[model samples]
Target: MSKSGITVNDLLKFSFISDPQVSPDGNWVVFVKRTIHKQKDYQSSLYVMNIQTRELIPFTQGDNRDTSPRWSPDGKTILFTSNRSGTNQIWKISFHGGEAQQVTFFKNGASQPVWSPDGRSILCTTSLKENQSIEETESDAKASKEQEKEPEPYITTRLKYKANGQGLLEEKFSQLVFIDLETGEKTQLTEGSYHHNNAAFSPDGKRVAFSANRSEDPDFTMISDIYELDLNSKILTKLTNSEGMYTAPNYSHDGKKLSILGHNMEYKGATLTRVWTLDLHSKELICLTGDWDTEVNDVAINDLATGAGSPGAVWTANDDGLYVLASERGNTHLYHIGLDQRITTVAGGKRQIYAFGLDQHRRQAVIGVSDPQIPCDLYHVSLDSRKETRLTEANQHWLLDKQVSLPDEINFTARDGLSLQGWLMKPVDFEEGKKYPLIVEIHGGPHMMYSNSFMHEFQVFAEKGYGVLFMNPRGSHGYGQEFVDAVRGDYGGKDYEDIMDAVDYVVEKFNWVDHERLGVTGGSYGGFMTNWIVGHTHRFKAAATQRSISNWFSFYGVSDIGYFFTEWELKTDKLDEPDKLWKHSPIRYVNEVETPLLIIHGEEDHRCPIEQGEQMYVALKHQHKPVKFVRFPESDHELSRSGKPKLRIDRLNEMAEWFEEYL
Candidate 1:
């Protein structure tokens, strides 16, 4: 009998492991495991593994969500954030295994726990108002209900007031504070309205380094600077000259140097994230990857590892250099970037490694990895010997009897002689020569790349005898900065041609792909391209646009990041050249659409607000064109990735049904 094929339902059966934390003693690793609960919601828990024997140990199996597991200095305890106590709070569980004890009871909740070097206290982040501190007691649930009954109106006068995930922003800022493990004493370290985040404690524990936009008129320039806070002297010194969006400040083993990551937005939204180093003694900051073209951060886009941690620079065992994530071509690799201006691939392959944690000695590491055939799993790596050991089979149980389609890498030249890369996935059971319907998958970001990561949606399509094509066209990050920025100001010009050329290349090279049965779908930026594609040509038989942008005119003020993003991506200001945005908007040429279209949108999506979907659906319908609108209530732009379990299934079902009906 043939093995079962991957279905949308299998999404609930798969376990997603992320944020691996290596124990200080280098004997074990801990990570968060997320899975669908009762097919209705997601439940995240903690699990530990012994490096020597690879024995899996279940720690927290409760119904509540647990995440961000961090090892204590002595390796006798584990600190994690969970909603087991009704709200997210820090909890500590002993290594011997017993009931976990609540360590923090902050009213605003806490996360990103960092233990002091001496292990006498712990520092964590929590949202706080200008006048508040971490010592504030947890708000009463009953009082919370009372306040909800009379929700306060949002009042803001700042450009950076709103965020996509958090919704209409408040005056609350993320602050770091210390908690005495013995007395539960709380001490606040950051203040003010601007966020003070990405903090790291010094080796001697006398100073704390963090990034914040504590500059004058922070809402305007919006540049964050690195600062060192003296715990005893209560003096704060700015370390960076506010040159870029520098963040994730990590001190060296000797605490004489700091490594940071971020870009100058020098190329606007398409600027590749680069690594930087700072000498604390001389106060000299050096751009480590200034001459390099590689992106110094994980830009892989996938739904498999939701809430996965993106670790910054990990110090080497000798502290002479650092291990950082670098994205090149189409994969996320661990690269060793040294102060001596040398960069080499450490742990790299045709796979996506989302998160990793190094031992206290920086010897071994535990990484979360996944590819087209693998959902998500943890692997242990020996830095000295370059040996990688699979620590867990998180989804192998379900995958063992399932038919997972692996993709074939494709490289083709665009019409402009630009080299483009993508992948082509054949149907689950392929024949020598058989025509199959093709579905072109587009990724969002326009800056983020569709890597060799596992996508459940693509697997579902492949299982249904449909060939899937996903490519990293111009404006995609894995390529160099020039290619990524090529789409700016030329939005629908070359980027659209790059995608169309890929489809043409596949149609000519792979005769199995039925040219007559071409369909296309994408979310966010991909969604925008879908709208533009269908409007521009009648080549695609059908198209599904999710969380798309139909009108850049309205997008200016409506989107959470619209005010600035519109200027950055389109290279046009709403006031100076409003028509330029409209010229590039997909909706401007809606009358040219001839393909049967499906519109999928999340009501709560703030990035490419639901209005974009409504406009596309209504415009096509008004012109008496083929179109259907599918709206997901209480869902956001992340609906397809980390939305409610049932809603995610419903989304896949809708798209599948649409393709089956049209293709």
Candidate 2:
């Protein structure tokens, strides 16, 4: 059995599984296994498992992380992106397992390889522009050789003001590259001064579909036009010209129509990614799904190759317009899409739906699922019979005696009578009517959702004898578009009240919560909220704000995704609306803070810079408040999940210690 209460070492050894890729034949699945290394920071590798035999094998093993595995047309080869070659590049290997071969060689890097339908080529995106190199000039060198040459302007100009992961003004562009499988030659497809991504090949091998924000929409970074490429003529044609962003294009097996995901102004800040199909001949666009709230996570069309009893996804040669897609209906699940665009629930529940595959007959499908107890396992499901067959015993034995807590869904009404939803995990050894210290766990994204799935942090709190409360307040994503937009321009208003009411509800009704000895913590936007909460109210005795945003002014320029996100959430552009930004800033209300705040931040976090924490620490110390700052050297914004193993463990230990001392 695992040790009780999270330890520094336990945090270091934790690993995560993501990006599960199922092969076309429905025989194997490959996925990325991420592990944190205390010394080096992050480590990951690719692993493969046979669906029929239930045999698992490690594909690539090294110090560097390998991810984004894509299967070739014949299913005999696998292509993945890796940093083993000193930079991220496409690497290929046979399904039989042997020495992996590097596919692309460039000065910068390339990733996300997708195969062409004919198996003759592959498509990958590369951001090749490098930062200008400053050559050191020596005084002793020949001065005459450098004479009479006019200096070129070093200034770079681009209309794009904000980016998702890279904040501030972005002047660079990413282009698509097509690589020949047989000759090993490569050709750059799209060029000029705009970013293009998410390329998909047409089923007939004649054209390719991609999303791009070209010279058409220079200022609006969110407006992406779908383009179709005639592979033979090297000509590009516009498919959908709109004022919103469109991505993840997929071609029907017959190549007569195209389906893509799009988000317009009506979606607000969240992605109401609905499936839209375009007719190639008529140039008419058809909106298939009416519900904009139901986001289509991943999509695939049914083909003749689907297995028996499978949902007959329109992927193979079968003329049936069937497809299998995944969506977040409470939890992630695979759904069967009929010819008329009707959706039927395929497989999903409290446990996560990682990935799925269907054989030729479309009668059965293979699913990858996991929970708090089971890491991830492959299961065979008959779409017709609805029978599930467990194929892998990967974590069966290890989870046999695991002492994990089942979180109970709890709801409470805020002061404004708005219904707030959340989950609470009692101690693993829960006692009846026992008053225990509480830990209010907050989620980041301010836009991201905290689902019913198993979380390591919640388990750690349960083992530490603290009642963990995590909720989906007004700003969470999965609760529809209106709820997500509620926090926009109104930070700390209703959202804070909802959280406060949640704590009050638990304290008043549970009788087990020691209201006076409560602690609060969260990261990213959640960290921002934590800082905001401790400043506005001192209901909790202690607080741990990890990767928090204490100041909105600095955050607008410092964070990678802040340039637009800041304006989007605060409802104002920087320099243009200073007062509005100040009104939403937590630092503005720091004068009312009484609770002890322990700040945990990463040294190299580009999302929320370290200075945010430093300034908060300085302000608190200057005011003579009980505050402490802990910095993890050389870690990014994902420090809690992907930081250095040892440092992450240290972070959790420090947080627990802070609450242990004050709460």
Return model 1's CA RMSD, one decimal. Answer: 1.4
Candidate 1 TM-score versus the reference: 0.98
Tens-place lDDT per residue, model 1, 537-610, is: 99999999999988999988889888888888999877989889889999999989999999999988999999
| Location of the lowest summed lDDT over 10 successive residues in candidate 1 | 139-148
Q: Which candidate achieves the best TM-score against the true structure?
A: 1
Give the clash total for candidate 2.
34
Model 1, runs deviating above 4 Å? none
Q: lDDT tens string, model 2, 6-50?
A: 334544444555555667777777877766654556677888888
Which one is best on lDDT? 1
Q: What is the TM-score of each predicted model, taking all chains together?
A: 0.98, 0.87
The lDDT, on a scale of 0 to 1, for candidate 1 is 0.87
| Candidate 2 stretches greater than 4 Å from native | 1-8, 36-42, 130-172, 216-220, 298-330, 339-341, 357-364, 368-370, 392-401, 574-576
After TM-score superposition, what is the CA distance of residue 559 in candidate 2 from its true location, in Å?
A: 2.9
Question: In model 1, what lDDT does residue 183 have?
Answer: 85
lDDT of 2 at 201: 83
